[model samples]
Target chain A: MQDPQSQIVVIIIAITIVLLFIGILFLVMIWSYNNKKLQMAREKQQIQDAFEKQLLQSRLEIQEATLNAVSQEIHDNVGQLLSYAKVQLNIMEQQATWGQEELHAIKDTIGTAFTALRNIARSLNILKHAAATRVQIDMLYLPEQLQINIHDNGKGFNVATALTNKEGLGLQNILNRARLMGGAATIISQPEEGTSIKINVPYA
Target chain B: MHIHLYQYTQFLSLLVAILCYEGLCKYKLSAFLPMLVIVNLIEVTGANYRALGYIPWLSNHAIYNLNLLLETPFRLYLMGQMLRMRSNERLTFRGIAFLCMLVILLNYLFLQGPFVFNTFSLILIQILTIVLSCFILLRLALREDIRPNLWQDPYFWVNAGLLLFALITLVILGLQQYMQDHKVMLGGKSLYKAIMPLPNFILYLGYSYAFILCRIPKARSLLSS
Candidate 1:
């Protein structure tokens, strides 16, 4: 039979080895547990980012679609009307018996054409600015709010008309996106002044 | 076992589990209460037999071996169900349970006979359970759609508690051979039995907490966003 001391040493060594193995296993578990937590957090963040990006893309698409429709309406309807009015004024001017009042009316008609053209140019500017608008994003860590402000140097509109106009589908889209993201959106603008749209979304 | 400290712990755990039966029922974990009651019954039966006389064939050790055989597949089934829910994948619970039953039967018939303590089967179950628990935890962590708050989820608590208990038990099981050979030199058989109940305590206490704390989700809705 083996000595009791020698047997105790063997058992101690065996137990120690098993303990070491378990220690290694425990460490591995802790590492994996922390690793899983980090991975979950990363995945959640990616999902949030993807969702937000999709919202922004859809908003842009709607805005671009609305702008295209507006430009088409202006060219096909308002532009055609102005061109016809100009042509009629020119034809009246060429008549044999044109009076002073008729000449004044002709000049007034020309003035209206100029004004219409200028307004058309301003509308075109609004479209261009909308296309080129820069969106600045700032996340407030304290309040956990994401603020997105779109800035444009273009002819602005009356606040009431922009808010209530069915034609301002772009603004409506922005507001919808803000609401979807659990936030609010507002447009700040004055006639002939630049427009700035601010959207606030809850980061949480 | 007439262990004073453990008896109190067991009593507390059983009381809590019984009281929170409604919460467990909501989670479709109503089976847990009856299972625990059966466990307590088995414990009492084994103790009664041991007190009657040290009949090796009808001892607590034999009963433990029998319990291991019955509990392995049932535990696996519950874990598998939880895994399927969290993974959103169709897991073959029946197939896995069948395999476990086969393995335990084979081990009992060949390696560790019916009358003897079945360390091999217990070790095998521990290893498989640990691996499955790890896989579940990894899947939960790597999931993209919604990351659940682990503290709030009953399954998370249950799995975590089981994992902790299994890990410690695995270590003890691994050293079983050494302990068996030097039983007298180390401090005799009671050392092993004394150590085994601790992990059980942790597991039962954890289950009780889960019963109390968790607002279990609906069927197949495991993850909480």
Candidate 2:
């Protein structure tokens, strides 16, 4: 049989312990719930990123294949046709009974047409090669700059080694193109971490 | 006449409720405004009953006991609204609330009588509120569509406040009962008087924050537009 004061003390201690337990339990519940929500959001973002990457890869493949075919057709058929036409014009110039100035003008016009045809074929080939190397490309239009971000989930190479090696012509070409367009390109990659390339160019 | 610090907190919460009336209406929580007004009025009148020379029959204990009757259903209804309880769940809770009220009325009329403090009903209300608040919090935590920023949620704050107040008050009130039954005194003051204000202060602070939180989403939307 405890005294009244001692009994009161015991009751107070018991109540304090119970309140403390409840408070801790409440806090733990809220913390775990918020943590679960954060984890779910992260997983959702990852899935969305994977989907976008897959879609981009498929689109790039199709575009590269189509452009390759077009470049082949232009080189095999159009170039041959232009060359044949130029040869025929040369022959006609050599045997022409018309005014010399008129024949020279016809020959010059054919030469210009052949040069334009070759330029178009070369540009298409460049595009096909670029599409083959890239895994994903995102373009963002800003007030004064156009930003392009390219990401690849590939076995990444050492960026410094690639930039210096003769075999890294594709990497060098990207840098040179960006410099020529008054822009800058940044390449980030690690051995197993995948690659990211960002290009920022002034929009004029 | 004297006003305690806890009563000031309740008044502050009422001010916030009034200021956030439009935002509360937007969130279908305008009922809290009138509820808070009633709560503050009760606190003020109860605290100054002696100075105000009220009728002898209208004791402070009776006023508070009556307040318990009004507060239980009002709080349960607000929590149900926050939970978005389905029709069947709402019906079940309403039934439970009715039973508790019936029990409280019976205890007040037959067991404790009106003049004496109704500790039984107070304990009953505290337990019921604590259980309901815990259930609301658990549902909020486990629901599939739980808000990402739950800390900013108005209902979360409200339930947290309710749970803290109920848990603390339940223990304190029980201790008060023990002291009374055992003829014990704690430094010449009732344990209830010494400790009651702390939970009240915390509860009203939480209410003020919740009222402020009710306006935050509307402000955010307006800013975005």
Candidate 3:
């Protein structure tokens, strides 16, 4: 007769082995799944960046066209009028009907007005997608967190409006980029003060 | 004649494995290396006792009890570290003392009958190890952060080796159970009674794989970061 005892022991051990195999297979599946998700997120970000570049080019083209139109109006219309006014003042200065001091003061005021117009015309370079408008983006690597700040010396806005509500295209685009990076943007600025946007993204 | 040669030659191989492990302790793989090699030694001792039980001239002898002398605490510590370690290189000698207490308790409870101690101890070791190993694998599976299985990493050879051992154990036990039900051993030749050591042989293969796997660098990397 066979020993019924050892057989019982054999059965118990066999069951344990099968359970172990199942456990190991389950662990491998979860690890592979997480890796797949990380790779997909990286690829999606690349596509978004390419689309943003194309859209930025189109917007800049339209903006330069508007600036160019304004520049032409100031030069062709107001510029000729100012030259005629300057000649009339020269005659006024020679006749001594108005003091030389008064004539020079009016000329100085007109000169300041022309300088303001020229400043607006200079910005057309950026609007026309000139090489000078290229923005330098730097990403700082830190433990567990990523900080990206875009630096540009231009007119800024109230922090409350940018954070609470989407207003201008510039602020809206900054917010969009922050969201893409899995973070929030902090805009620190005043009316005359320049703009600085800070974004922090966490490692996945 | 072939059987005699196999028995004698196998004994030499087992002895060499044990001595080589002792000599190479500087390699530090010996942290749990002795436990594996000693299991075969225990089997040899137990087989001798079982033979004595069948032959009235010999009785429970002193020489074989030497296996028990160093075996209980050594095997327990060896196995305890296998499941419980943070790393292969980090073994606490202090934990070994505690494991001996648990093993002694198991022996006191389980060693009641006339059945061979080796047979029961072998089965017991396999059951406990399988449970502990499965639990470790379960933790690895449930975690979201561990690296994917490094199949190419040599260090993971321990993992792959453990699975291989479990598989072989599964097959051997399943066959033994089948053979028991069929009463295949009833009329077997006395000399050939249980000479087949396929199950234990595979168990030894598993240990050898584990020992050699500790030498693999990639296995450590997979678990570390």
Report the error of model 3 at residue B140, Å: 1.6
Whose TM-score is higher: candidate 2's or candidate 3's?
2
Clashing pairs for predicted structure model 3, backbone only: A27-B141, B155-B219, B156-B219
Model 2, position A196, has a per-residue lDDT of 83
Worst 10 residues of 3 chain B by lDDT: B56-65
* TM-score-better candidate, 1 vs 2: 2
Model 2 C-alpha lDDT per residue in residues A1-204, reported as the tens digit of each score: 888686775677578568847865885788587668867877898999778667655755776797787778777766666676677677776887567776676666667667767667555422433333447879999889999998876667698998898866667656756765678999888876667889999986
> What local lDDT score does residue B224 receive in model 1, on the 0 to 100 scale?
35
Candidate 1 segments whose C-alpha is farther than 4 A from its true place: A1-204, B1-4, B7-11, B18-30, B51-58, B85-93, B106-113, B146-156, B171-182, B185-189, B216-225
Q: For candidate 1, give the lDDT.
A: 0.67
What is the fnat score of candidate 3? 0.05
Between prediction 1 and prediction 2, the one with superior DockQ is 2
Q: Once superposed on the true structure, which residue ranges of model 2 sit more than 4 Å away at CA?
A: A85-143, A146-204, B174-178, B181-183, B218-225
| Candidate 3 stretches greater than 4 Å from native | A1-204, B1-30, B34-115, B150-225
- DockQ-better candidate, 1 vs 3: 1
State which docking tier applies to candidate 3: incorrect
Rank the models by DockQ, top first. 2, 1, 3
